[model samples]
Target: MSSWQIGDITVHRIDEIPLPPETGAWLLPGATPEVVARADWLGPSFAGPGGELHLAVHSFAVEIAGERVLVDTGIGNGKTRANPAWHDLDTDYPARLAAAGFAPERVDRVLLTHLHADHVGWNTTRAADGSWRPTFPNARYLTARAEDAHWAQGELEPSRRQMLDDSVEPIRAHGLLDLVDVAEGGTELLPGLTLVPTPGHTPGQFAVVLSSGGRSAVITGDCVHHPVQLSDPALGSCVDVDPAAAVRTRTGLLERLAGTDTLLLGSHFPAPTAGVVRRHGEGYRLEPVPSA
Candidate 1:
């Protein structure tokens, strides 16, 4: 139960599952041992002693006033996935979410960075009749308009379509999904919570930016998937829709965040999860600021 306070906002990280060591190689092949070894800062946390990148599937829960908001839901339970690590099984994600003080029924918003199968898995859950249903019955699932549009017209892999049928389609069919138009400056979905456009990973991907009083925090969707990207923003994920665009967005985002008080909350970062971005060598690094 790790939580952080930025001004009046309290962000809670709800754990789902940890990716196997091989996840680094499969997801970000460019982050080879030689590449990760160059950035010796990732050891024992983001990466292993042997230079293996450590990643996890988790979601961030934030409650402002009485409105509870959830960022990127992790790989869901019992979903048929192509990736062996994300395949059908069960985990205590729902219980952990409830324990974090933001149960499904209590969530008001589900903000998705993109429409990736992994990020949207928990959008729905199996009901008594065994039909997929929106987990947060009362929450409005939000994502970029561009994101939904792109996937709608595009030909998807069989597994990806299955993901949408169970997780995303149910929300849309239930009138629970909201397609938000995020401008260049970002849209203030809530008083203090802003959804900023960070396209590239997906044309519609957006990072959540929470600002309150003089304090601030930014949730990196897939724009900056791992801290290793901070060491080399050029490294892109295998699934990136626009690899080159991802690198550009990542490089620019890190530059604005570097040397600031803004807390960088990684969507897939391992423990000691929250951190501040700082200038390092020719790129940047996450200066871990352990949760309060």
Candidate 2:
């Protein structure tokens, strides 16, 4: 478990699992061995010495104002995903959460950045009776209206269809789904936490911004998947719905975040996911928090 404290809010990263090199390359088409070697800073953490990249499918547990809010539930257990690697996962995610002191029933709010399979999996779980049920029994599952409508058009892939049925629809049926509009400025979720539109990877993607005691941090949701993107803002993910738009959103985010004290918490980055963005030669670089 990796964690960071921002003012009164404490954020914990619970890893659902780590992605292998082949899977990472499939997700990031531009990331070849030669290309990865350019970002020397990724060594041993985000990238192996042999240029194999490691990515994490994890959730951020944000404890603020006495409410436990989970950002982006990682791929869930027993999910019948289309991707072979993700299909029928039998990991101990709930046990991991409990190990980190975040019991399922104790989670009060669950925020989905977008309706991607990996991001929304744990929204619900399969009961022993084989019925899909909300994992967080009492938490309100927050989703963007635009995201739901976009996926509802039936244009999504087969895996996404399964995701909607098992992860998303169950939350709605459980009377815990809250659809909100992701606007330009921001949508305040809690007192100090806000959801800001950062589309590209998905039509209605939003990143969470936390500001408290004059300190700030951004919980990026696929807007900047890997730290290498900081050095090459133009590097786009193959999964991006709009590659060009993703570049623009990513570069804009990097430009504004560079040289700031704000912490950058990459959603898919490997262990020690929190970092600071700094302006490099022409683009930016991620300065990860020092290992303890």
Candidate 3:
């Protein structure tokens, strides 16, 4: 139960899933050996094949004042996703939310950084009738209008579309989807939370910037996947829609936030997801948040 306070907002990570070898290779090509070794060091529970790379699935929640805002609900249970591991997610995210001191009814909003399956998986859950339904009955599911339009018009490859349907459409059906044009800068959806466009990983990806008590934190959702990417901003996930644009966005975001008092919350960062970016030789390095 990791927690951090940025300004007046309290943030929590509710991880519900993980990445597989192929996914890890897609993010860091030759790091599979290193990744496997690191997993082994963590004990047999973390061990995996040498060629397989597994990344963590991290969902975040922000509590500002009395409003509870959830950012990026990880892959949900019984989802018919393209990725085999994403299917039948066994983790009880709702129970995790309760353990984190947030009841499902308390979530005021759900901000999806992008429509990626992993990020939006918990948007809905399987109902008693065996049909999919919005997971948070009280929360308004927020997404970018541009992203929805792009995927709606474009023909997604089979695997990708499977994710889109399970992770995105259920919210649409509930009419709880709030589509915003995040390309416009500094849109304040919540009191202390603002949407900052961080496109490239997806056509309309956005980062949530929280400010309170003279402090600020940026929830970086897939804008920069790994600490190594900070050293080589040019290296992006193979799934990036626009590789060059992603590099530019990542470089600019990291440059702006590095060395400041601002806290950076990386969605997929190992543990202690909050960190500070520091200039290191040609690029940057993530200085983990100190233990309280």
Top TM-score model? 1
Residue-wise C-alpha lDDT for candidate 2, range 79-164, written one tens digit per residue: 89778878888898999888877899999999999989899998888898999998999889898888888787857677677788
What do the candidate models score in CA lDDT, each in turn?
A: 0.91, 0.87, 0.78
In the predicted model 3, the residue pairs found to clash are: 7-212, 21-53
Please write out the lDDT profile of model 1 over residues 86-153, one tens digit for every residue: 99959999999999888889999899999987799998888889999899999999999999999899
- Write one digit per residue (lDDT tens) for candidate 3, span 1-292: 7888886788888877667646767666644466445323322222245535336788888898688899999888887765677877788788989888778887888999998888888887778887778888998999888778778886778867877777688788888999997756668887788999888989889999999989999989999776556655776788889888888899999999888988888787657567888887677767778523
- Using Cα atoms with residue i matched to residue i, what is each candidate's TM-score against the true structure? 0.98, 0.96, 0.89
Model 2 / residue 21 / CA error / Å = 1.3
> Which is the winner by TM-score between candidate 2 and candidate 3?
2
The runs of at least 3 residues in candidate 1 whose Cα sits more than 4 Å from the true structure, single-residue gaps closed, are: none
Error of 1 at 49 (Å): 2.0
